[model samples]
Target chain A: MGTIGDLGEFALIATLTRRLPQGPAVLLGPGDDAAVIGAPDGRVVATTDVLVEGRHFRRDWSGPYDIGRKAAAQNLADVVAMGARPTALLVGFAAPPATDVEWAERLYDGLAHECRAAGASVAGGDVVAAPEVTLAVTALGDLGGAPPLTRAGARPGDAVAVRGRLGFAAAGLALLAAGRDGPAELTEAHRRPRPPYAAGAEARAAGATALLDVSDGLVQDLGHIAAASGVRVDVESAAVPVPAVLGPDGLRHALTGGEDHAFAGTFPAGAVLPPSWTRIGTVTEGTGVRVDGREPPPGAWDHFPT
Target chain B: MGTIGDLGEFALIATLTRRLPQGPAVLLGPGDDAAVIGAPDGRVVATTDVLVEGRHFRRDWSGPYDIGRKAAAQNLADVVAMGARPTALLVGFAAPPATDVEWAERLYDGLAHECRAAGASVAGGDVVAAPEVTLAVTALGDLGGAPPLTRAGARPGDAVAVRGRLGFAAAGLALLAAGRDGPAELTEAHRRPRPPYAAGAEARAAGATALLDVSDGLVQDLGHIAAASGVRVDVESAAVPVPAVLGPDGLRHALTGGEDHAFAGTFPAGAVLPPSWTRIGTVTEGTGVRVDGREPPPGAWDHFPT
Candidate 1:
């Protein structure tokens, strides 16, 4: 109804946090000094990511609701990538004093809805004033007593498989950059990546050796697994799935696109994978990543050196 | 040695996270998708806070290192305020690409140092590009099997006590604003308020009826306790401590100053309190807070309406 400044700190906080759904794991929710989340495994998985205006997203292309969903999805994707079940989120929001209270509330609505989708809760957070809008989200998760699926566990003879959509966000981003809209799915993916939330535990149960989410494209992220596991990953381009809607750009997007939030992992070479997982590559005794037995060009998102 | 842009993302991340000391609770530290922190009590306490450039801090007044410590200290204090022992911190830092890589490294050093001071660790974090420096810090904690001390538990006739510092930071800010220095102790307190980390556990063990940290002045924070617990708090002016340097202004500063990170708690009447605590007030059968049975002026920090 009014600007954040008009509503004041206490009132603005009350409005944003009103009607939030706290999950079962949240022993103590918001409006406190801090929140208490149940770590059923006696261990907690935590990760944080910040999205800045203009740099990460443009307000013209994505609304506050989608921005909120994107922020929560990224951090939750990280927890799932670690083979943990999402439990709670703590958000640190900063915006100009002139920001409309309605925008902030809608953002919280998206945040709460996403947390519910992931089976987590919006527990606690802080609000501050800044020149530009910035959302810093921290997601906490439970491991259910299983060992974490670290990137250093893959062996040379492991089969590489991935679960969840690949390259759709990147393609969507390109469409947005070019001022093109419909194929709304791609652009929407850029805003809200549907991370395979259950895929993490499934991989763990299937005895995945090494695991990570594909945030910085398939090749770049898999390179991390290669470096950490001391092995080489060779992806067969033919085996990579590309949606027909993407057309000729599909191959390129599937291979080099970012913001997919897909899980890629290695399992025993002959082991059968969960149906959701698509076999795409193999881990071999070497270093670096290869596309169809050849080195792929350098590409992926970076924070600096533009 | 070079700017963050020159060093790029991976190298800069490596430099910032290198040689970081992780505590026993951290099963996995930086360089992973997420961190695994041991939740000794099977429940995790979490809180998040963000500091914006020029808003929360001034580059000329304090360097990156002190800013890092301040950010970590505030979030850690929130966890401790909930009667939990901090376990890990997840930092989301965004800075301009032109920022000095060494500056970022120094900032991380202070974060690590402060975490170690509080028996916690820098488990994991993220770095991104932004127009201005924004550091969002999230602290995770464990209860050690004790019940949390909430603000809603106080009852009339309970004795109130406070541990740690008060007013020094506010006084330091006044001096800084006047372009004065020396009284280095007070100025140092402004840069990094020493939170009584152990006092929270001490209060918990001693059966605190209600508890909270004074981040927004003594009266303002106590008002939260009063409102939530549905009781009045009458602070005895004579019992409040005043440093020698503060002179006549000491009493006013101690009552209205903010950022001391001190803890205030209520105990059953005549209950033995920890040695460090100073009995300052009493919970009363009424509404609102009063100083010597009179209302004090309105004063406290807020994010908006500036």
Candidate 2:
């Protein structure tokens, strides 16, 4: 396959954008200095995330497609956590010119796949040369007139609930670090997370008082909710749902391993819970996260770990 | 000042977001998962650009403030080229953990300064650790109920016009590449471009048929308009404005140097040109860009330069 340098910049963009499907939200896609996307509700919910090659993902350990999918999944999860439906994604991709063009195509393929899965489209993007591969993803969403479910809305006596799977990615990371063989499914979850795309609206409709995307481990993410809401979040270790695939360390992974992308929220006591969600804890007047009224261990994913 | 690692991700973000002005367009600012910005017109015009450390800008050549200003200026220009007024900006910055927090704070100051000059606000952003410094900027604009002026709208018999200074950045770059000391003014222009942000609406209101931001040299950008509109763009070399600083090579810089970020557009024949715009060329029945009835030199900025 020819390298990106051989194909040139504009030609490479043409190759990457040619086959991607454009959704109704995108009024203008590519071929221009800017893109126009519909914001039917007269407002836009925006979020951005950047994934660097070595710091965020190892090219040797994950395929381009998986990396692309994971990048899109994480950004989309941010919009969903705010109780909005993602409308479009704008990607900024940078890589060495010597890299094969096929790699870029596969990476974009993964991005397209994830966007399609989320009912969103890749509206526009920028491609450039850099010393290391990187992806900067920005997601735009529509609220459909509902107030955004922020992390500060939870109150004392609220019930904390979670929707979707957790812990598989952490366990998969353990296996990868140890060079131990693990189930294909566990490793796959680590490579490409499957966040419940529709669960955010479900939680909002059920009157979620506070919400978060479980990207930095359940306890760590909930700690943000606790700190922001000035409420103590106490979880029952047994109530925390850990995938059976992680074996005995499932609970540990559930508590500290990041990138599960599950929906976690707090609702008014006695409010009906969505079928996808399970009550895991209770909110009380205090500060910070707790496990059975005790302090939890000190392990959560930090971008710049001390 | 402490390094970004010592400050940590959350603290770093807090320091960067603190005191930055949030305009009325931003319903929600940082410290949350995402930001909510008013779209007003039920549609949004969006664009993103990534600036890598070595490829886009050199840390040694430009101060953090200048870098930040340049980044925001280029992105804001993209939105203005589409005849939309920029409303908000979301920035994603990545750098080595050892980077100074003061550096990040200054970069954001530059971003805020430029955004305010363009009548926009900093809505939300992400900061992460990377091996090299990189910036990914996404700009959102509102059409205010006006139909978007696209590059494909130009027709034969249209007059091509350009607003703002041209070739200064290119000449500035030439001075820098040769290690020759040029006038401080010329070098500053290369460091930071001042695009005429308000002129986009003025051109649109004056019946501009096609519009473009001349980011990649006049000939190169106008080529895009010609290709999209299926018409020939013939520039009059004598009519093209060249900055006086480049001495005898002013016309060369005007024709081939990039990053001027001047606004170029096509208007119907006999249409009164906006006072802000100066006539530079004419559109005719044909394809491709020509200067003074001949093909211009084959030099324009490309990310993956061969």
How many clashes show up per model?
0, 0
Q: Please identify model 2 stretches exceeding 4 Å from their true place.
A: none
Report the CA-based lDDT of candidate 1 relative to the real structure. 0.88
Candidate 2 Cα deviation (angstroms), residue A7: 0.6
lDDT of 2 by residue, A1-306 (tens): 899989989999999998578999999998898999999999999999999998788887789999999999999999999999999999999999888999999999999999999989899999998889999999999999999899999999999999888888888877777886568777788888999999888998899999889988999999999988888999998898876778888898988888979989999998999778989999999999999889999888887643
Per-prediction fnat values?
Answer: 0.89, 0.83
**Candidate 1 stretches greater than 4 Å from native:** none
Clashes of 2: 0
Q: What is the TM-score of chain B alone in each candidate?
A: 0.97, 0.98
Can you tell me the CAPRI class of model 2?
A: high
**For model 1, what is the error of residue A24's alpha carbon versus the real structure, in angstroms, after optimal superposition?**
0.4
DockQ of 1: 0.83
State residue B166's C-alpha deviation in candidate 2, in Å: 0.9
RMSD (Å) of each candidate, 1 decimal: 1.2, 1.1
